[model samples]
Target: MIDQYSFLRPWLFCLDPEKAHNLTLSNLDRAERWGLLQRFITKPIADPHTLCGIQFPNPVGLAAGLDKDGKHIDSLAALGFGFLEIGTVTPRAQPGNPKPRMFRLPEAEGIINRMGFNNDGVDACVARVRKSKFWQSGGVLGLNIGKNASTPIEQASQDYVFAMAAVYEIASYITVNISSPNTQHLRSLQSEEMLRSLLHDLSEERKKLSDRYGVHKPLFLKIAPDLDQEDIHLIAELLVEFGIDAVIATNTTISRETVKGMEYGEEAGGLSGAPVRAASSQVIKTLKARLGNALPIIGVGGILSGADAREKVMAGASLIQLYSGLIYRGPELVNECANALRR
Candidate 1:
């Protein structure tokens, strides 16, 4: 059962990370279909917060990457996340990097993954989102988009623009993810010139989509945790200049100082979980200082407890999200965070 994930943890941990993830979602799907998930999934207490013109029932969200293809929306929503985000879905489907791309560092309570935007593509993901009960449940849903791995850095906007067009009508908001380190040259999009062009193109496209759908869906930019003063300042400037809707700070860290010698510590992928907590909060702090009220931030990265979630909000995050924490703590972290924020 979902809440009884502790009982299944040992068995799930025995399999490969990706395989375990697939099994978990598959079982969740089966449970939801049988109407048995509600027994295991707790109802998150209500604590409304609105950002990007959308009101969330609560602030704690299930971050993107867990349901890359939007396949388990209704089932995953049973966990009581205030909102749910799906995909890093691209214009085309592609098998990501080779096997063993995801590694669990249990000792460090972190995970390293280079799963390069491997989704069922924008079309399938959109169709699935349109079909999910969560989509029509009036719950906040964000569709995170990214360029395909094979897409060149020079023409990355094409993939983002295409994916945005496909999901625009249905998503409560769209997240432009240019921060994942797994894709080659993907983070290069965060550079000033490229970042400007990417935001500019998406902004322009949003206008047309708004007119076509008669409603505008907000566009949030997801950034990486490894940033400096210059990087943060320029990104804040570009976001404001382009009128981006919101920002999801600190995707995952390429920095490994926190887990250097631990098993699977040297793996070549972005690191997340307890290891990235401080780095993510600091990014939120910096962005809050620069953006002020001009933009709102959704803080994510390494939130494993209520205090960690509270620290993010105290640091100026408009809201927070979880990925690795959910993997390590199970569904209870969702309610723990919701209650913490309510207090």
Candidate 2:
């Protein structure tokens, strides 16, 4: 496949990171409308697989954050991802941090963004998802839910409950995203005390929703890569205790040791991309050792090429997702990673 991004990336890089992000999505949205996207896409190899009761056409998926409000789903889904995960949508709409919140660390091939779960409210996102052709197009859809920025930490569970119920019917699975560094005290939800309470509430609600809808949609927790062995072990134990469906091995990391001297290296958000690969894979390896097939693991972080993708699987990820890789390497990375897994 020709690398159209080779021509586009330089121009995109010249724009401010957030502006570039919006432009890429808007352009793809337009492309989908005109039915011109297929001309740019080279379909990935078939590697259909099942995880958490959902069938993914391949192991590679578009991670949440890229299409925060579910807009551009048809365009992104058409780019040959096995599935598409959208949003970290909260119960209510709220603008995120001020400008320059997102930054690029090209030297380390990482990005730091404190774009604190900036998304349309859950209701609005639900409307967008309902309108998107992808929901009805047989592609796997995972809706990621988060707490609103203004909501107090103690009241976080209410936001999660509201978002989960709002999208439960349409979601193939729901992602409990409590690890994004951008949200104040959000990672605290991962602590032993908060995590137990949070999962308990979500699990109980899921049971009722399961009975009501006659479908048990799986729920996965997107965790942080920065965790000690003790933390990982306890989190693994909690997964079994709560009967959680699957685990997305990592969100982004707050640690900056990897890119300390690079531009934007000290930015105040989770750092992602190549710098996150090792930490993310290590988490997967640790979880796999502890869980031992209790549930599937969807690995993500720093997957910029087929080799990087394979590293996550080799570390025991049953599946993988991408965000930064799609930015630097473009859609062809999807096929590259899918083919790597096929081999």
Candidate 2 residue lDDT tens string, 1-343: 3368878998999999999999999988898788788876888878889887778889999899988998889999888999989998999998988888999888888889999888878899889888888887767999999999999999999999989999999998999999999999999999999999999999999999999999999999999999999999999999999999899989999999899778788879889999999999999999999999999899999999999989999999999999998888887888899999999
Q: What are the Cα lDDT values of the candidates?
A: 0.91, 0.91
For candidate 1, which ten residues in a row score worst on lDDT? 1-10
Residue-level lDDT of model 1, residues 1-343, one tens digit each, is: 3447778788889999999999989988999999887876778878899888888999999899999998999988888888999989999999898988999999999999999888888999989988888888677889999998888889999999999999998889999999999999999999998999899999999999999999978999999999997899999999999899889988989999999889999999989999999999999999999999998999999999999999999999989999999888888889989988889
Judge candidate 2 at residue 203 and give its lDDT.
94
* Cα TM-score of candidate 1: 0.98
Give candidate 1 regions above 4 Å deviation: 1-3
Tell me how candidate 2 scores on lDDT. 0.91
